[model samples]
Target: MKHRDSKDEEKVYKINGSTSSMGNNRKKKKNMQRLGGTGLSLEAFANAKSMSNKYNPAFKKKQREFYKNAKYVSKYKQSLKQQSQQIDAFSAVRPIEDQNRTRDVDEKNIKNKNKKKPSMEELYKKKREEEEQARIEREASIQAKKVGREKAEAERKATRAKMFKKTKYGQPVMKYRIEHLLQTIQSSSRISVNNSN
Candidate 1:
C-alpha cells in the first residue's frame, strides 16, 4: 500500500513490519529505487565524487561557486530561504577600528618584508655560536658547582674530624683562624666529668 507524503510526493512504506535490520534493508532498496536508485553512503558518494572529479577537475575552482551551487541545489528550500533572510551573527563584518588596525598591521608586515634576509650559512653560524655559548655556560656552571661541593665536603670532614677527635689532655677544644676571623669551640661535659681539684 502506497500513501502520498505531506510534500504531495508518493512514498510507498512497507505495510508490514520493516523495523528489523534485514527488513529495513529491503525498505532501503525500495526507497533507493524511489529516489532514482541513488541512495549511497557518504564514503561511496565521496569516492564517486572523486572519480567524477577526474572528468572536470577544475569545475569547482572557486569555493564561492561551490557554496552558491550548494545553496541552489539544497533540498531544504524553506531552510535556505530562512538562512538567506536571517542575519548570521558569525558572518558580521568587522568594525571600522578593527579593520583599520588589521590594515595597519598588514602595512607594517609589508614594510618588514623589505628588510634584508640572512643567508642560510649566517643563520647556521649564529645558531652554532649560540649553542657553543650555551654549552660553555652549562659546563662552567657545572664545574663551579662541583668545585663548591668538593670544597664544602672537605671543609665538613676537616671540621667534623676536629669536633669528633679525642680531646688532647682530656680538654675538648678546637681553634681555627681565617684572615681576620678567629673561631673557637669547646665541648664541655658535666662539672664532675673531667675535673679534679
Candidate 2:
C-alpha cells in the first residue's frame, strides 16, 4: 500500500481525535444556597414542618367528618334531582287519551279501595282454592314423571332379558349371533357372485 501524504494524515488524525479532555476546560458549578428566614438548620426545618400543630389529629378528624357529610349531602341532592327529572319525563310522554284512561282507572281503583273488604271466610276459601290448584298441577307432573320412568324401566328390562336369556342346559341363548352370522355369509356370497359376473 502507498504511504499516506502528510495532508491526508493530518486530516485523518483530526477526524478521529479523542475528545475526553474537552469538558475539563469548563468551570465547575457551585451548589446554590437555600435562603432561610427561620433560624433553623435544613434537617430541623424539615422535621418542624412534619411536627407542625397546623396538621394536628383533631383538625384532621374534623376535616374528614366535614368531607364525609358534604359527600352524602351531594349524593342525596343528585338522587332527588334524578327522580324529579324521571317523573317529569314520564308525565310529558302521556298523551291526552292516555291521561283520560288513566284517570278512569284511578277512579276505579279508588272505588275498589272504598268497597267493603272480603270476609275472612271468603278470603280463606280463595286461598284454599289456589293451593288445591297448585297441588293438582304438582301431582300431575309427578305422575307423568313416574310413568316415564316406568316405561324406561320396562324397556331396559326387556332388552336385558333378551340379551341375557339362558337355555335349559345353562348355556346363553345365541339367536342374535346366528342372525349376524347368516347376514355376513349372505353379504360374502353376494360379493363373490358380483366378482364372478
Candidate 3:
C-alpha cells in the first residue's frame, strides 16, 4: 500500500481528571456505599455520637474580657514628650562658631581653593586618544559585519547550486539562468583590488 487510510485511525481523546478545588475533595467510597442503602441521612450520621465519649466545648460564651493593666504606655509617652521639648530648645542655636570674613575675602578664599586645573595639552591628548580608540572600534565592527555577510552569501549560493544539481530537467532556458546566477555569484565572491599595475 502506498499509504494507510487516515479514516481507519482513531481520533485523539483527552480526559481532564483535574478539579478546580482549594483542597483535596476525596470521599470515603466504602463508607458511602455502606451508608447509602441505610435509611439514615449523612448529617444525622455525623452528629449521632455516643454520650459516653463526649465532653464540654472549651468556650461556650462569645464575649470575653481581659483583666491585666499595662503601666509602661504612659511612661514612654511622657519620656518622648520631654525629649522633643529639649530638641526644640537646642535647634534655635548654631552648634559651631562662624568665622568673621568680609565678602571680598570670602570670594578670594573660594578662588584659591579652586585654583588647580588640567593643562590644555593634556586635555587635547586625551581627546585625540579617545577619538582614535573609537575609530578603531568602528572599523573593527564594520569588518566583522562584512565577513558575516560574505559567509551568509556563500552559504546561500552553495545551497542554490546544490538544489539545481539534483534536478534532471533539460530545458535550455532554465539551464542558462541557473549557470548565469552561479557564475555571477562566484565572480562577486572574489576580492579583486583595482590598484594593481
lDDT of 1 by residue, 1-197 (tens): 87666433312233443344556788889998888978679997788778874645477566668888787778578777778766444335657787688789999999999888999999999999999999999999999999999999998888777665555587645443231133322323344465853
For every model shown, what is its TM-score relative to the native structure? Answer: 0.34, 0.32, 0.31
What is the per-residue lDDT of model 3 for residues 126-187, given as tens digits with 9 covering 90 to 100? 99999999999999999999999999999889766655563446534466467778888877
Clash number for every model?
Answer: 0, 0, 0
Candidates sorted by lDDT, best first = 2, 1, 3
Given candidate 1, what's the lDDT at residue 168?
A: 58
Sequence-dependent TM-score of model 1: 0.34
lDDT of 3 at 114: 98
lDDT head-to-head 1 vs 3, winner: 1
Error of 3 at 53 (Å): 99
lDDT of each: 0.70, 0.81, 0.62
Best by TM-score: 1
What are the RMSDs of all candidates, in order?
16.8, 14.0, 24.8
lDDT of 2 by residue, 1-197 (tens): 98898677656765888322332333222111233233678997788679888557678899999999999999999999999999889988989898899899999999999999999999999999999999999999999999999999997788668767889999988995576578779999999999999
Q: Which is better, 1 or 2, measured by lDDT?
A: 2
True-structure RMSD for candidate 2:
14.0
